[model samples]
Target: MEKKPSRSTEDRGISRARFLAGAAALGLAGAALPATGAQAAADTRTGRPGRGLTRRGVVYTVGAGETPGTAWDPARMRADIRAVRRDLHADTVDVTGDGVERLTATAAEAAERGLHVWLQPTLGDAPQREILEHLAECGRFAERLRRHGASVELSVGCEFWLFVPGIVPGETAQERIENLQTGTADPEQVQRRLTAFTARAAAVGRSVFDGRLSYAAAQDDEVDWTLFDVVGIDYYSYHQDPADYVRELRRYLRWGKPLAITEFGTCTYAGAPQAGGMGWSVVDYDKDPPEIKGGLVRSEHTQAAYLTDLLAVFESMGLYAAMAFEFLTADAPHLADDPLHDLDMASYAITKPVRDRPGDPASPWHWEPKEAFHALSRRYARAAC
Candidate 1:
């Protein structure tokens, strides 16, 4: 897999200290609890107290079988989904992957566990027709789940500009990203293509799915939210004031639709929080077994703080849903004894999958929760009640 370019504050030409200072000047709270609680009392959108973040969830990925640690086993998928509800205290689960069957089955398992299902099919680097077909099939399954009393929503696609081919004249996601960065790809043309494709996706989803429709847009992707029921964005905050998120996200409110932070969370490393969405790029995948680039320090505390801080922001804004980027990256296992090989430091998962321990006699895989897991459990437990 190619390294995703970082969307850090520095990348956006904003100095961290300057942005922080500006945010403080704007009276944004630096603390997690107090300011958010106060903001929740009066939603900026309505000038009244709004229901803040009704759905708390995590992204659960079931990779295609091409990978070694794909969640292909039905029993294991069930157990993982059960943990999302029982252990994490999340009310929703965003099931994302490429395989139509795997995505449907895992979403069903989450629904069975009484978790709201956000069926997101990510068919990266595939033909447009194939991607639409995958989404159509998933949509059909989602409608069935909804008819069966499951709370389900179908996200037709995510980051389609990079994932879907011919959008920006690149063969791969990385190349397309680079092309956009270097000015080789025209932004207006990309938006035109993205707009057309998103309309088609929404039409296909509406054709087969009767439930609410959404799309997990890339942080910078321009989307026509009027086509969908929910305004969802994969928001990743760099070293900016929480108030910055409110100011920027407030624009989406113009559509008068509920907003969802579809993807947010940082890797477990000292500086990972500052890296934001591109934190995972720390891994050098060119090697046979990918290894963490040198000099990065592992810090579970940083990851925990990053998540709660963002949750506070979302709560203050009275967002509808906030799904952490992931539950676990099975392929990125933790090697406690080997710093260079500790891939978990690059994963956004709250659970740390053991390197040598795939599972015990009772299960096919095993993982231990990081500090973020406990922090999220406490917050979600309180919010759900």
Candidate 2:
């Protein structure tokens, strides 16, 4: 992997000024920063509502097979995770699933190697009953892991906001179906469901390990700062400048909850002439660049640079933890394609042609580490200490 270029003197000068400005605003200017874990946690949670638990370091994730299959070779998965740990000096990995069996096994594997595990549950397109059942199942799994002396740092419902009603205006029944299919729903209803699910999860946590429990919100709007132990947001800057992205992040910081960049990435698709902005283009990755049948272009160095800048800002802001969107995949390029692109369904994907061609599993973007991944690993390695 290539090393991230060192910041120029001028860039460093600007960063120093920004840092000082932020410090002064936060009233930390000229104060001796807490050096120990207990003090650090206290500093972070003093005025905050929930228990103060600062993340040990940055966390990253990789998806297993789309559905359960031998496609998720345990040895290969372990090797990839081990390589990432060595490269980034990271100590945590996130594994997502419907229940705890797979997650428990994965966590056990990670623990043998001394890495912390963050478990994420995919709350499929089930109604309230199913969602609740899934949460209960996760609680049981969490208890099992705790019994084995493993700790779970976070529990996420991958994309709950995408299923809520009225979050985005759906003009027709097709649009409505598409919205629900993608899990986009009204923000208020999202809050209700989130509150209920989290409260239930909390009850489970009390029965299990004494560590923290948190949910990964799809976007800032989906985040109920008051309800969650940590404030989690996804940062994909392909559509917006890094500065503007950080500006949006400021809102969550005010809630005083430790923040996590739960998911962040750029799509391969470039902006469309008719597309309103970069944000819209990224959000609808399967739609722009009309000439490409699948809608996505190959990932670019520009995307990597954007990620580098975004991480720098997060570090400067003193964020609690951050995780990249994903690692390797059995579905490779188009794992996120179906619900993202299906135009007949509501067209969230920037690319068209939802599925990859038969036998050729390479995603439109493929799995080779882009400049962004390399840049991210280098930054994370340096930040780990």
Clashes of each: 1, 23
In the order shown, the candidates' Cα RMSDs to the true structure are 7.6, 13.6
Please list the residue runs of candidate 1 whose C-alpha ends up more than 4 Å from where it truly belongs after superposition.
Answer: 1-51, 69-71, 357-365
lDDT string for model 1 (1-385, tens) is: 2333223222222221122222222222122222223353334323232356878999987764324454467877888888899999999999987788789889988888899999999877778999999999999999999999999999998777767888887775656655765679887888899999999999999999999999987655678888999988876665445555566666667899989888888889998776655576677756646678867999999999889877876776778999997887775677787788887898888999774453222234478899999999988898777
* Cα-based lDDT at residue 313, candidate 2: 56
lDDT of 2 by residue, 171-283 (tens): 32234334444557564664676566555555554454356666765443444456457766644333233344445566668887788876554433343211211222222
Best-performing candidate as measured by TM-score: 1
Which candidate achieves the best lDDT against the true structure?
A: 1
Candidate 1: deviation at residue 246, Å?
A: 1.8
